[model samples]
Target: MRGTAAADRQSRPGRRALVAADLSMLRGPVSGVVVLPNRLVWAPAPAGRFDLDDPFDRLRVYEIVLREAVHEAELRRWLNGAVLVEVWPHLYLPRGVRQAWEAIHPQLAVVPAR
Candidate 1:
């Protein structure tokens, strides 16, 4: 599925400011989560998939997954065939999810990995 609302929301000023503020929280170039207008983008490998051999080839798949046990089916109708995970919400490690957390709180986010 395409993220039209995501593209549109990025252009707005208030949302842009929020994005900027969120971006500022990052220590350096990283692969984690980005909260856009209506969607969430997760980048697991910020280094751009070092596991790949060809650099130019290989799918830098973000997976757009949710591993949490409870909110699996109830989360989304638009997202089908997406990965799912089960993790304790507040007690989880601070990876890139911190940024996503701010944007989504208890709601599941649609992270767009680049």
Candidate 2:
């Protein structure tokens, strides 16, 4: 059973290393985890008051976005200048993954009268 589930996990394409130069805003102790269609995102608590766009000033929030692929593609392919949205504090989802993430975990639900 465990093996079957593991089989479904596809490694992302690209170098997993964070470029020493590229500054990241979402950093520090992992505050939350969100699961997407074929990816997993781990985020740390926001260390400062500044937003992602202006990470240069004050403390920065570093986010590590990964693709679920067996052969890693170039780091820029998926995450380069990619738009990101914060679902919850520290928890972020890439623009491309928003709908899919929301589908699995909707903010509002419609349930039959119980």
Give the winner by TM-score. 2
Q: Indicate the worst ten consecutive residues by lDDT in candidate 1.
A: 16-25
In model 1, which regions exceed 4 Å deviation?
Answer: 1-90, 106-114
| TM-score of candidate 2 against the unseen true structure | 0.22
Assess the local accuracy of residue 101 in candidate 1 as a C-alpha lDDT between 0 and 100. 39
The digit string of per-residue lDDT tens for model 2 on 72-103 reads 23223333222322322233324323333234
Local distance difference test values of all predictions, in order: 0.26, 0.28
TM-scores of all candidate predictions against the true structure: 0.17, 0.22
lDDT of 1 by residue, 1-114 (tens): 111122222222333111212221223212233322123333443432322222221112222222121122212421222121112222232344334333533333434333
RMSD after Cα superposition, model 1: 14.5
What are the RMSD figures for all models against the true structure? 14.5, 14.1
> In candidate 1, how many Å is residue 58 off?
36
